[model samples]
Target: MTVRPTDRLDETVGIDTSRPHPARMYDWYLGGKDNYPVDAEMGRQMLALDPRVPVMARVNRAFAHRATRWLTEHGVRQFLDIGTGIPTEPNLHQVAQAVAPDARVVYCDNDPVVPARAAALLRGTPQGATEYLLADVREPDVIIEGARQVLDLTRPVALSLVALLHLVPDEDGAHELVDGLLSQLPTGSYLMMTHATADFTPEESTAAVERLTAAGSTVALRSRTGFARFFAGLDLVEPGVAVVDRWHPELGEPVPGRDDGTIPGYGAVGRKP
Candidate 1:
């Protein structure tokens, strides 16, 4: 179920062409035309550092699909997804609604371009509700308030950070932010995440981060142990914190370029005890 962007897209939604955005750059990685030349240029620079950047994007997305499916299959019917990029095929609502038609989803992102594309995200099943929030993850209160309008915080909700945290630096209190959000949910709620790491290729990863930072994009590559600490108190699922492709492989099709080398990212799902 591929989602089409709104025809009413306004390019002036605070979009900055002078610097690259992680969302638009991600769109480029997925081969979508939503990105600008600046984004493409930065993406090419990252590619030069590691030719598998695009492949890593696909692998990370595939991990999201698998984790969402796993949660919905386990009886989670509501979702609070922060940092949702351009609405790609089988958006969170679509994936959840496929398993449970009444699933409700609230997507939040600070990206100016994301709200402009909310039309596609809103096209969920009649039995469910899908809403997008034009807010940043740093403002947890704002995101939670917006999400409360669409989801029942009293019930179990999957808080999907996905690939968003690596962009948030420790100086920003990344762990504190996660804790603040989790505090608002019930005991049965879950956290689904994937983040880029320097554990595998420290040298190239450092250079890539420097380049992206020079381009005005914030990048904070963490260690494998650092990634594991995000799920500190929660109970991890089986085969914990493996490379994106190695987690629950039976849930999705194979992504290309995975066998070449370490994918430089990690994905995992953890439940609040």
Candidate 2:
């Protein structure tokens, strides 16, 4: 199904291209042309800190693909993907609908660029539905309300938060925001997440965070314990909380250089109740 564009181009105003945006930086890291020079410059700085930055991005994307396939196989037909970055290929709906063509997905992100390029994300199997919501993860009510238009909230919806929470700092009530989103999901709903962390290389992680923060982007690299806190009351899947690349590597092709060293991130899937 082709999801119609709900946002106008004028809504893309207020984009501060002088500074780097996470979504654009991610696009740059993935070798996409959607990012501007500022984003590429900041991405280069991040790579200087950790040369494996691009590899980590691929690993995280692979995890999202594997987790979505697993969820669809396990009977999840609805998905709410928050922090939807610049429309990368094989998006959440593409992965889920591949396994279950009838899957329904709602992609949400605070970045205006996403909505502007959302047409790439909206193409789904005719049996399924895909919609994009221009909202922030902190605004749980807004996300929920928008998601309901496409996904049946009472059904099992896999909330995909891959590579997002780390961008939200503690001062912003990150944990509270996650709890709020989970509270609205049904008992059988799932949370599929991949978060950047400082546990593997504190010095490099710290420097990267400092650079990003200085560039006007929030970087709250968490510890393994802190990442696990987001799934507190949920049931973790097997091989729980593995490094992003290590989580079900059999489910997808390995990201090049993933085995060279730790990826400095954690990924897991958890079911509510």
Candidate 3:
């Protein structure tokens, strides 16, 4: 059943054009036209340091797609994707429902601009459902409640935090927030994540984080061990917490430039036992 879009908030959340937002900046990196000049400027700065910034974005996006397909093929029919950025084609629901036509998806993002383009998010198969929630990942309670409206909490759901948690610093209770949200899911539910890491290119990654922080954007590129802690209680899928591109590359197309330089991120999927 197609879900009729609902207006949850009465006021339109204003988009801040002065500073760079991760979503818009990411869009800029992906060569999408939905970003502002300010976002492009920051994206340019990121590219200057690592010319493969766009490749990294694509690699991260590809992982999200493959993970969704993997989960749906494994019998999952509901998804809760938080930290979902601007609507990109072949979105989580589109990928999941392509395999499981009756899949239900709820996408949440803190960016105010996301809601304005939420229509792109709602366009899923007629047999499937997609809904966007204007909420922050930091507030897991609010996100869970919003997701509950469309997804059955008793059934297994794949929670995707792809290419997003790195934008949230540990000081913001990032780990705790993930745990809180996962606690709401039933056993057999899965945690699919891709986190940027400084493990490979420490100098460049550190400098990138500093530059983003100066512009009011934060990037917390965690170490391999730090990223794994996010799935402590869960059983990790095979190829435990490898580099983003290295994890299940056989499952998806190889990202160009992925091997030429360091991808600078880790990706993994874990199941709640």
lDDT of 3 by residue, 242-268 (tens): 888887777788776666666888999
Ranking by TM-score: 3, 2, 1
TM-score of each candidate structure, all chains considered together: 0.94, 0.96, 0.96
Q: List the residue pairs that clash in candidate 2.
A: none
lDDT of 3: 0.86
Candidate 3 positional error at 155, Å: 0.5
* 267 Cα displacement, candidate 1 (Å): 0.8
User: Candidate 3 regions off by >4 Å?
Assistant: none
Model 2 per-residue lDDT tens digits across residues 1-273 = 756655543463577789998889999999999889999999999899888899889888999999998899999999999998998888888888889999998888888888778765458899998888888888899889878777787787898999999999999999999889988989999999999999989999889888888888898899999999998989999888888888888889867776678789999999998
lDDT string for model 1 (68-91, tens) is: 899999999999999898878867
Instruction: Name the top lDDT candidate.
Output: 2
Clashes of 3: 0
Q: Candidate 2 at residue 6, lDDT?
A: 53
Query: What clash pairs does model 1 have?
Result: none
Off by over 4 Å in 2: 7-12
